[model samples]
Target: MAKVRLSAAAWGLSAVAAGTLVVGCSVSVNTGHAKPKILKDKLGDTVATRLAATTGQPKPDVTCPEDLVGEAGTTTRCTLTTGDGSTLGVTVTVTSVDGDNVNFHIKADETATPAAN
Candidate 1:
């Protein structure tokens, strides 16, 4: 996992609460024959839940174009669309994989893309 430095305010978290935010989730993966993948919807839901919990806002809508491979260094871009149709870019990266669990990190863009007229 690469070192990431962001102030708590960046994530809408207080210094104390930020410490409690574990940015990863454990999703079941089949380890047998093929590379495991985190389903797109599941990944989006996980991201939405985490963001909502940290920001004290309703869960935002998230959409990913494809599944994320369950391998360290794997990354996928997802979009968080606001009520006004402005979009925030979210980058999700796989940090590590342990048998059935795929741990990942999430980072939201610093600014939102304004809604189109």
Candidate 2:
């Protein structure tokens, strides 16, 4: 049998190298257009459908620009046409842009009031 040995220093270096490599390989989703995509996604599917059905609002008209982008702590405006022929403004704010994952906050625009069915 062959035996191999590594020094403490060597093991420490290897550990550090592995950690660095992992950190480097970690990826994050870009805020570019991610903001809009998230908004549209939630709205076009669950959020809009639920809101419209419950609120007696017309099918929501989700409007988001393909070019809108943002960074953590940044916000962008989005709009949806409501049932009452009124625009329901919303803000898509980026909370985190981390490794293939993005965290955000979506809410009605500060000046807009949400209508309850």
Candidate 3:
């Protein structure tokens, strides 16, 4: 049988690595915050639908964060990517929440997209 020896520096590094492997690990569960019923994705979809209906044009692409912790009455601005690969601003407001029904408002702002050469 052969005996193995480790230097002091090697022993210290091994200990640190072992400690990191053991104590530096953690588990994070993202249940999300207890937010209002109105979320950004649904709100964006609503905006797209309403805009299409009001303008009689095709529904533009609407994108929002996957998670939005909204208050009962709060307004936030989200970006809207149109069919032309240009971005616009859409303001969203969560007006109220009644029972299981949630109410919100969306206003599309007309900001011209710069010409791409």
**Candidate 3 lDDT over residue span 1-117, tens digit each:** 642333334333433333333222221222233544545577566665655555444565667664333445666776656434456555666555544445555655544343255
Q: Give per-residue lDDT, candidate 3, residue 22.
A: 25
Top candidate by TM-score: 1
RMSD of 3: 23.5
Residues 1-117, candidate 2, lDDT per residue (tens digit)? 632333324323432343333222312333345333344454334333433443343445556543224357666655655444345454555666665355555454323334444
Task: Compute each candidate's TM-score over C-alphas.
Answer: 0.72, 0.43, 0.57
**Candidate 3, residue 39: lDDT:** 57
Q: Pick the candidate with the highest lDDT.
A: 1
Candidate rank order under TM-score:
1, 3, 2
The number of clashing residue pairs in model 2 is 5
Q: Write the per-residue lDDT of candidate 1 for residues 18-87, one digit (tens) a residue.
A: 2245344333444343566778898899877776677565666779888888889999999877666677
- lDDT (C-alpha, whole model) for all candidates: 0.67, 0.43, 0.49
Show pairs that collide, candidate 3.
none
Clashes of each: 0, 5, 0
- lDDT over C-alpha atoms for residue 60 of model 1: 68
Worst 10 residues of 3 by lDDT: 22-31
Q: What is the lDDT of residue 80 in candidate 3?
A: 54
